[model samples]
Target chain A: MTPVARLSPDEERDLVVAAELGDHEARRRLVEACLPAIVALAGTFRRTSRIERRELVQEGIAGLLLATRRFDPSLGTPFWAYASYWVRKAMQELVADLARPVALSDRAVRVLATVRAARADHLRQHGAEPTTEELSRSTGLPQAQIERLQAAERTPHSLEERVDQDGVAVATVGERIADPQAEWAFDDVLDDIEVGEVRALTDLLDDRERLVIRQHFGLDEPAQTLRGIATGLGVTAERVRQIEAGALAKLRASLARPAVAVPNET
Target chain B: MEPQGTALRHDALVYDSGDEWVELGAAFLRRGLEAGEGGVVAHTRQGLSLMREALGADASEVRFVDVSAAYTRPVRTLASYHAVYAEQLRRTPSLRAVADVQFGPDPGEWDLWTGYEAAFNRSFSHLPAWVLCTYATGSLPEAVREGVWRTHPGVVSGGTWTRSALFEEPERLLRGSSAARRPMQVLRPLPVVDGVEQFRELLARELVAERMPSARVLDMLLATSEVFVNAEQHGGGVVSIRVGRADGRFACEIVDRGAGFDDPLAGYLAPRPGVGAGLWVARQLTWCIDFFTSADGFTARIVM
Candidate 1:
């Protein structure tokens, strides 16, 4: 058996810092150290489904990564205490997903909608609250049925589409987008773009035009208006507008013309 | 606590013939005397004699009334006599009929006692009020008993044992209390399988669909497959499996048509145990396990 050496407090902190800075080995070590805790939290929801265990573990790992990124050493609380809330919330989401189907029957949804509508109407007209019995009688449904519907109204189902083929249910989005094959196909399409066509477009734009366009649209938040773009570029709104218009015209004209076929493909 | 009434020294006894009409009448009198209140007893001469033998000297105080003579009297005269006797008894207000055999007690008292007795017997026996009433009225002939037993096998077999009777009321019995009975749901038998893999897969699918807990569902599947495997390897090739849920628990039973084992657990747990690992695993997984084996075959139940 390999004797495991325990890390000192300073060493642990350094490892966490290194992992957050994108050190693969440090990240792997951190995950190994935290796997048991994550698995235990996931096991709390074992009464739900086994598939939920793997999913919750993955979710916990994601939360752990996020916590590492956002961790503040100045905060008095330990890292585990800070990450506990995220881990619990992930597990709760898994349990909620498991309980969704039985808790949200169709009849219940309709009954709830009807009751909400009736309550709104009653508040508008009578200005007095209606009793549960009165509501049940008014709805022409039994009190028991109404109570079941009320309980069902509280739980919600996940919105992801699932396809069941040959008795195996799988998520369509996960299968399509998360697979390596799909990533390869996407890369292939990007690769097929003509390099000369791209160079011609780059040549058509000056440095200022390229920077404005890239900062405005290619980054997370697009520039809201011409003025915002000009402010970022340290230029006049008119100059920013001229650059944007010229960049757009060049791209449009290039797209309108035929693509230069790569000889290697033939 | 009310003040204690004086204890009356009295004894009334009853006997049964094939008819046993007179013994029932005497028994009614005994109950009344024991209660420190008097009541009538209507009986034939032969029944009265049997009661006399049973009670000995205590029988001496009993005022015997011949129902045969009452029947022979003119209807109008008898009716008038009955009314007068009833009124006279009310006025006297003693333990009036304790050691006596008479046609009936005072009309109001008769109605009250019979109704009270009906409620008492129903609660005591956990049988229906109608059955108690029929017994009290001496109307439960063999034919009536057979009919009732046939119609309601559960009642006949005494499944509804009344653990408490203090809270029972005549009104509740008359209203037909449904709470006294447990609700049972029946399900069709599932096809028997040779291995646990298929059963586990089915259970896993059901669990993922939120039909049941994965552990309990897996436990039931494993337990059921264990029983089936027992039947296949030892008893025969395969048997039948039936599954259902009751009282928030799942249950499955496997039944087979083959020679039974001497001791079910012993055979399963003995040396060179064949397919016993399955049974052991099932036991660990399930909450309760039971087996019934006879010369005919075996039936095992696993509750989870």
Candidate 2:
């Protein structure tokens, strides 16, 4: 492996200045020069998993790129000094992501769902939502332990559970009655049981639609221009507009439902 | 003795005042350099422009020492800068005494200044003498007064008023001051699932309102949303959000109710394949990002 060469402070500053001024070559040079420092910093986390090292380095590189573009030479400091914070922060985030589980086991996910249902049922049976303390008392678990367990489950409880409302049902909680806009947004992505609304929104669209939506909404890529998306999609710019409108309409229709029926009516 | 000798020879001693003093100190340092005698000055890019005009054509080599102040104590920044400067001085036999200037006039300000002074004084006591100057002029002291007033504006108006106004005009001190703004907006507790969307919307609105470029704001919103979503999916949807401005920067925080990982630093050090992009997206989006997760919860903050 070739050893990474460290740029002198002035060279680094020059690269940063040029990069900030939209000089592509200088931006590339800045990334190349800082790559070694980033790698060495990544090395310090040797105890981390191999996955973490790769992620941290990549994150560090991204940070270095951003630092280059945003770095103002007028600030009177070397680019490296300003870049260090972003680099380390990127590295730390990589470590944190690794430590966090990306995909829960199917069984664990099911268990969480069941636990949430059971908790809600227990609250309904008792005529009041069980407090963490009460749940701990009834379940014979430490409060902290219960809290931890609950977090792992990620079950969202409704506001009604906390109040003394007996007539409200779980299905009613999911009803499309109260706020039409929220309900429409919620319904548009509710079809896929496995994924939540946001993820479902992604799944609902075709690749072109998804990319356009993501770019236009600034979801995935940096902001996109209408012309850019239109060119990418091989459609007229007006067609791009039609596509967006069509997608939003479909989403709204899929997610929207008639207002809830009044109780005991039909 | 060798370490002491090295400390004495350095042209200047640099200290990290954390984010707290970087701006004020940089301003002071720029002024000092502008009154130049070919003195070498080093700081972050944010502080560099002010000193550029002061850099003489025949100025001695000016080296910038890059250091992290996030999650570091003010004393730590000072200590690390001192170490770097001392080492450099040791290498240069020709350089004479180091000039150290203390800035700002906050109450605890003395603690950091005095500590640095004591360390340098003790370390370089045996060497040839150098001047240690302190500046609390204009906005430097104004920042300190603002900090005090935010907490105790009444007391400041009473006895401390006269002392605070001496450094700068009272109206200039108070006008367009960050102290007038609320310190932090305490958001209602949000579930990790729904809260992430709400937080993203709020961040988007703020970014648009502030006229931050669309690309930058979008990047931050996406990265933050991902973190919050992960908190809900893995940590049990326990999360909180807070936003505020401090020290001339905008900050947003996303806290999750989850025991921090067994090795908090390990995740960033070694991430699972293909998942590294989320963090990369985050880093690309913000000027500074900090993460703190413990047995109880995780807090990720972004500064722009």
Candidate 3:
């Protein structure tokens, strides 16, 4: 937070020379002169909290001091421009360090980075985007990892975000997510049928016959096509369809017999 | 910048991981120390922490600076290094420094930084310093890594340093990128508001009305949403988005009015601890991801 002195070019050069010679006070003042750039550089890295921002600023100060010590006025570059790189470097390094532990190898991170750059370059260079094959060739990373890395890098969207301004939802991506058991149970179309009718079928048909009719028609499932029922029962799908038709016919005849038949049917 | 009468030695080393980098750093430091030359390592926390652990007692002797300092801009980085070497050489005629920008292949960022690496050749054409620009190949794109060879006159890999036959001076290589590129066939581009919901609705309607493949629609949805978030987060104002079929594939372009990304991987790199994958997922689902930034702002073209 120290104020940097506004020195003339010659005087600043002198201060820079002194600072480079291990002169602590001169170095401190030189660092002060670069603080504005340091603070600005610190702002570039995104921080989650006040503490982390402060930490990044502290790191920038470290860079400022290094730049002061390393600054060679003989090179004719102004102090701040020379110092900003170190400032940015320090802050970015901190951000990189504070990075979450990645499940990927450092190399994979590098390769992913490479693939991204190549694609961008290809995009910019050519108005057209590059295919994975082009990226694989350009980036020299394997296509498989390249594909995976690209997939992993996109920002996730809340399926909830897909609605229109008027709240019309074309569809949702996350609706696919739900409790399996609840999904399975709530998915049961059989629940729509009366238990009495279910029981009537239970008594009217043999076990396999009732099971095939329900399963084929998707009474128990959200909707298992007849083909799925046949596969599950290890029968031809056509045969399952025939059984389903026969079962429905029998049920119709049984129901037609009226209320007096219910007790006797069981 | 003051002119250096002496020709500078610019070299690049490519490595895959922290361990390889540490080995290179250790040797770089040893050579400088043994030869009685000033030694400095511009370390980012990524490798510095590991290098610190690896060097044990030896970590203290080297003059360490942050790699970020030189990275805010390419020219600034070179100027900083110029100062660093110029200062180091005040004690002695020759010095050796190891610095890593740790530039992973970034989309917009790499294109910007390549010029920086290219500039190094001329920036230090005079100082009698061995500037080892370290690149972690583990993270770089092949083209960007290939760029390292073009920038540096020398290349070191697998324990041997050799003159790079691939080296091309910046003048020859740093030309207009668009010259070689063929423009894509774009349909009637649609004006889009910055709002995500509107963007989604427009995109969905277009895809569905076109009877775009369901899988393609999903990819387009994710890509558009991802790019929309990027434009909102990084760019501002009215954004432009459009969807069309090109080369028998569904394609989209999302353009924003910001200066664009400083790092090409800006959208992909998880800045916060718990942030979700951003553009990376968008790129993954799509057949292609491309980006460009200029005075107009940033634009992304994606196809699937």
Candidate 4:
């Protein structure tokens, strides 16, 4: 393992000064020194098909580089702290760029227009959507072009509707409509447990105990079986079951020693 | 925040390096925050950490679930996501989630994950959300990447996405999945009712003996029966059924003498007053089901 170089605050400012003055070695060293922090800040963002963690690192380095160039030691803030926000924003900006939907070129749209006319003609004549081969034959374009047009003919789905969709069923249905089972299950689990008891149920338990109890009883997802919970937690199924038992024991013991009177005398 | 208003898009991104990995995750969370839709991220430990920091102050608004910490079984991951996502939807009207659960080192998991991706098209369809289901480019081999294009409607690359020209419906993708192919115990053609019953009995007996989960066996039985019903009703009464084990799942193909139905969404649309929901039901219950029709005849194939 290589020993990490630590720079004194003054040394860091000197490196920044050298980097800003177009000193290549200093720039490289500065970027290298901040690489881990840059990676961590960049790690704050994500990767898409166009870029990956490397790109975020690159983008972070870009931010760090820009910050290096822009930083004035007079500000007195450490370069690392100063660069962190920029490093984060750089990745976030890239993320914003990647989240966008694809736009078709005008030529493709024009080709699509001609293809649609042909498809409509084919449909009129044959009473069915034309296959890529058939559309190619009718439109005088290549089979690939026709297929591209066919794909483009469909409306471009905006991701914004991820939440705007009022008709959840219509949006979700590709083949079979999934059954709606959440609200009922949730209500069933916590419906009777008063707000006070909800906290009281877990007040004595640790985090793992709380999670295991909730998951074991299907308080979150469909009641995950012990094996299911085990898989998620990367533990043995037996371990998950044991944790659930211990948590239950604690809860039962707590409930048995009731300091508060029974609610509603149920 | 709010995605630039294109609608109903399914995009796939194949990233060459780690930097690209978080691209979709960032977009998903950022857009969710922009629109107040709420972001949910299910990813590996490394991925979750990156995303949480990326999310920053907005991170609290988002619900981040570590898939590595949670999902134990690949087959169960989709159902688990479904149940969990459905649970989240109850709290908010819409959501955008990045489900980056990791699988592999064992190529065998390829088929299971593929089936989950295909099943998810319908399972998560109505949730009023966009989910970017990611796979690393370096890890998943070419054979594994085979049906990846078909399951998704588009591909995201180079900071832009395009409609996947090769995108095939999930059913067809599953049917054509190279991973799903294996030596079949081909059975002779059988007539309706009596023959179908015999085939079911054999499948039930064999699947149980093979130590397949009993509930899964029953589910496959129901899906297979639906196809048989369709074959008998739509095509001529005679049909042949082939069963085999491929990629850790029981796969079966039913062939009928009818010309292929080209409408990929055929039985999936709303049921007519008289016509039954056979194919639709088959889709719901199976791990993966696809419809293929050619001159030889239409074949309804399923993997469970």
lDDT of 2 by residue, B235-293 (tens): 66755666655333456777777764432111121111223334433443355456665
Best by DockQ: 3
lDDT of 1 by residue, A167-214 (tens): 887664334334322222322322232221123234556787766654
| B297 Cα displacement, candidate 2 (Å) | 4.1
lDDT of 1 by residue, B1-304 (tens): 2111221222222222323434444555465455444344334433344454444334534444433222211221223223333433343333333222222221222222223322322221211011111122242344333322222212211223222323334444323321222122463466665464444444334333434432244335445555666767777654666666543345666667766553323212211112234554454445446666533247666655
Ranking 1 against 4 by TM-score, winner? 4
Best by lDDT: 3
Q: What are the clashing pairs of model 1?
A: B41-B102, B62-B99, B63-B100
Residue lDDT tens for model 3, B106-140: 24446556766775665455456777888887667
Q: Provide the overall lDDT of each model, using Cα atoms, as 2-decimal numbers.
A: 0.43, 0.45, 0.59, 0.57
Interface RMSD of each: 43.6, 21.2, 31.3, 25.2
lDDT per residue for candidate 3 within A132-245, as digits (tens), equals: 999988976556457656644655454344534466766544344342223323212222311211132346778878677444333333335667878988999888777865
Cand. 4 Cα-lDDT: 0.57
TM-scores vs. true structure, each candidate: 0.21, 0.26, 0.34, 0.39
The clash number for model 1 is 3
Give the residue spans of candidate 4 off by over 4 A: A1-266, B1-7, B12-28, B66-84, B101-127, B133-213, B236-257, B260-304
Count of steric clashes across candidates, in order = 3, 36, 31, 38
